[model samples]
Target chain A: MMEVSPTLPAWVAIVTSILVLLGAALTLIGTIGLVRLNNFYSRVHPPTLGTTLGIGCVLLASMLYFSVVKQRLVVHEVLIAIFVTITTPVTLMLLVSAALRRDWAIGDPSVPVPPGLPEEAERPEPLPESDQPTS
Target chain B: MSVLTRRVLPYPLLSAFLLIMWLLLNQSLSAGHLILGSIIGVAGGLAISSLQIPSGQVRNLHLLVQFAFIVLYDIIRSNIAVTRIVLTPGRVAKSGFLYVKLDIRNEYALAILACVVTSTPGTVWVNFDSAKGELLLHVLDLVDEDEWTDLIKNRYERLLKEIFE
Candidate 1:
């Protein structure tokens, strides 16, 4: 058995423990929110809470631990953070858009597309007017 | 040269990110690492150029910095609050989804917001309606739907609009 160093900074261990616990707790809350929300759109908020801050804390703890132990700036974990930050919204957006399209196509009462907003907003803008005029 | 620059090194920020990631993962700053990383980054950028992802230009540096700091602080606070709820067990409020009407039309901005929401511990980004501009999110804590909407709109969306839109 490897001997544990008593000289290890107490704050690091303490902070790590707290962050892990926090991450776990936030995950639970997100799950709870999923169960409690009244509607499909309403239910979507909580899970994000867990995924964002939960993962953020856990990553922070990992970064802190590795950096302290290795005595180097170990930030490779930021890649995960960045990737998560970029992808989660995209997945959610796609899913939401799909759901909305389904609702609109079916003329579902619960989901209503606002009257003022144009469908064109949903798609990328057309090529510049200058280029089109030339054609 | 034009072809290489236009396709391969189209997005400077993205290439820079790739290079940084390569260096970080490899944990080296040697000449070999820099050269290899730069090659990969430029190549990767070229590969992505065809996808035609709408290029977003960020204008406000101050707002972005503020946004980052705010998110950091919120994460810390939420972590504490959420951990307490999880440990308590029996007292958890029922969870459910919220439909939020959004004023934000920018795909890139909305995407960033979704990531922010999903990565947080107590929330999940379930779906969004592009045509309707509605965001469907699942919450672990179902205390108030309006509150969540307000939080997203005020806390994150506002800054995103300022920075990206």
Candidate 2:
């Protein structure tokens, strides 16, 4: 933990501490859910709680603390917000798609055959992404 | 000069966004930094233009802003809901896949919806068969499939249609 600035207002300090603690707690919960969840697909949803709100709370705390201390707006946290929101989807989508492919190959019962593909034929190889919907 | 300017700043919107992002990241507004940031911004826009990347337009800024607020509120709300599910004692969270058929065809709107849905706590977008306008999602809690469909279609998709399409 960084040293609390002596000049920082008591209220700002208190609020910052609360936000930091909250961000940490929420992130811990997310990781806990990650361990507790049963399968890959369901596991995907829990960590997002940390990514969306956990990161958000910490960034807000940083922004607020810096703005109060420096007496100028410090909003670099928005960059994280923007980048995280942009990249998380691509990363998660690709991971799930890959997992789905492996699950299909292994004949995982919980995983449904990807829609619009032939139901009878088991696809071991990756299908091209642009395949038109059969239905 | 105009030709040079056009070459330097091939995409004004992208350049402006880059410049703002640079300033925010650096947390500086000094003249030297400003000049350097502007140069980088212009260079970025020029570099991207050479790639001939496609872009999308926002038809309504007001609605976009409104939609942003709605997403913020939902993220917070869902965060709480998901937190409770995780913390409750002996509560089994039944999860399942949800299929949503979307009508909004604009690529930008679809991209935004993807981000919104994925980042929300309880829902993770798995796949979107764009050719069929069908989206498959994995949800943390399986409460009501229709309710989720209605939430996505009406809450975000409708406004996204207005904003992008």
Candidate 3:
């Protein structure tokens, strides 16, 4: 088994440290946005920020640090980036759609539901076929 | 060939991206890894065939690069600004949410926009009304809703339109 070196080059350490701090700071801002922003829709942006670029930067730093310290290419971080990029949209879309559906149900004037509900929602049950099958 | 090329890999670029990503994360050029990664990539390509995601052909790659640079700079600047506000002893009043209309409609493009907005410091993508194309965003320091709106529409949206439209 190979072990990662305990110490990193001065430049590598400095760069990684700076990146980590930058990532952390960005994450903090996202959270602040989460807290400070008003309304449900308005609040959606911050966490996406934290999860996307915030995670992207942090993951990049990790990849760099491990690659350097371990003397081997370390790159699993991209999986996270991929996952975050792909899933954020789906989760956000679901949440937004859900919120919209609730608003529509409550008759909130602001929300506009699709002709019948957005494609995702379960449709109204069709009337049971008349007892006799039509010829 | 066209079916696989156009329909299966609707976004050859994105599929290529996934391939490179698999290699990077696995951190090996071993034949085993390459074969496995290729299988996964092909499977993924096939899976997206059902999504019917609209593909945007990027014309000016240069502008897209410029947009990336701008986002990087803004993230750094906002991070510093937000940190100051959070660490300050006195509770500085900072609260604001603004609704901005969006012009882009591609689901993939919108997803990218959401990621960009959320990833940046001091901003969040709270909600978007798909039917009306209105987005509600919360800014940590709401000194100016107009400024926030301008930043998003002019700064981000313009670049995104150039890249994806």
Candidate 4:
């Protein structure tokens, strides 16, 4: 069994472990912000931490580990990095825009009425202050 | 010869990008993979005609690399900053939406800026009113609105304008 698997150097293993743990800790903290933050807009901020640096660290560690194991540069992680960086923003933008539309339709005061569609913003009579998302 | 190939490969950069992507995904540099990647590149580049993707002319490739480094550094710094914001004992980070007018009109530049803003830890891209050229940014650690506006306009906008417009 030992012969089948290539032996990893102590330093590489240590660095990879540290990077993996750090990435995990960052992602966990980011998600914690999602649950912990009082407002939805604020909640959106934390998860991005997970998507950006969290995946970044983990991919870097994996690239290093596999590159060492293969005795060559293993950089397929670049693809994942590109995809994540591009897609996260696209998805986040869509989600935020959709949420904003819904809030505006419902006359949620927490979100400022959008400037682009003044008609839609004016259409909904402002809701009572009795209910608001956690600010 | 140049004109003929240009007709076949209308988007040379896209072709190269697709080829590189194929090579990276397969993790190989063999002859078979090279030929296959070329095929994919050609097909993909031609296929893009089906979609109406307005191509923006890139001005300075060198500045693009430098801009990428700046973004990377910012991302790392913001990661630490956000970590602090989340881990701090009792106080919640002061978060709010901010509105700033932009001068960049190129759609490609706008898209890139949006990605950068949203990907950064503390700031999220909420909305952009193209008609008004206004950006609605949700900042987690909202302190001074002017500071954020300057950061976007000067740090990113100046460089992006150089690159895209």
TM-score of each candidate? Answer: 0.68, 0.88, 0.69, 0.92
- Score residue B147 of candidate 2 by CA lDDT: 84
Per-residue error (Å), model 3, residue A38: 10
DockQ of each: 0.25, 0.59, 0.20, 0.76
User: Over 4 Å off in model 2, which ranges?
Assistant: A114-120, A123-135, B1-8
Proportion of true contacts reproduced by candidate 4: 0.85
Q: Give one digit per residue, the lDDT tens place, for model 4 in B1-165.
A: 498796677677899999999999989999999999999888887888568577678999999999999999999999899888888889778888899899999998998899999999899898888877989998999988888999999999999999998
Candidate 2 residue-wise lDDT, A1-135, digit = tens: 768779999999999889989998999999988887767787787788778889888998999999999899988889998898888878887888787766676555567666446668755654554442221
State chain A's TM-score for model 3. 0.77
Please give, for residues B1-165, the per-residue lDDT of candidate 3 as tens digits. 476467556667767777777788777888998888777777787788578666667778898789778977886677566656555556553665568999988775677678677666567666777788988765667888888899989998988887877
What's model 4's lDDT at A122?
Answer: 62
Candidate 2 lDDT by residue in tens digits, B65-113: 8998999999999999988988887887888888899998887788889
Model 4 chain A scores worst on lDDT over the 10 consecutive residues at A114-123
**After superposition, candidate 1 runs with Cα above 4 Å error:** A5-62, A84-135, B1-8
Who wins the TM-score comparison? 4
> Tens digit of lDDT per residue, candidate 3, span A73-117?
887887887787667766765675576555555544444443344
Residue-by-residue lDDT tens digits, candidate 4, A48-106: 88899899999999999889989999999999999999899889888887877767777
Task: Indicate the DockQ of the complex predicted as candidate 3.
Answer: 0.20
Candidate 1, TM-score of its B chain: 0.90
Model 1 chain B, poorest ten-residue lDDT window? B84-93
lDDT score, candidate 1, position A45: 51
After superposing all C-alphas onto the true structure, candidate 2 shows an RMSD in angstroms of 5.5
Total residue pair clashes for candidate 1 = 59
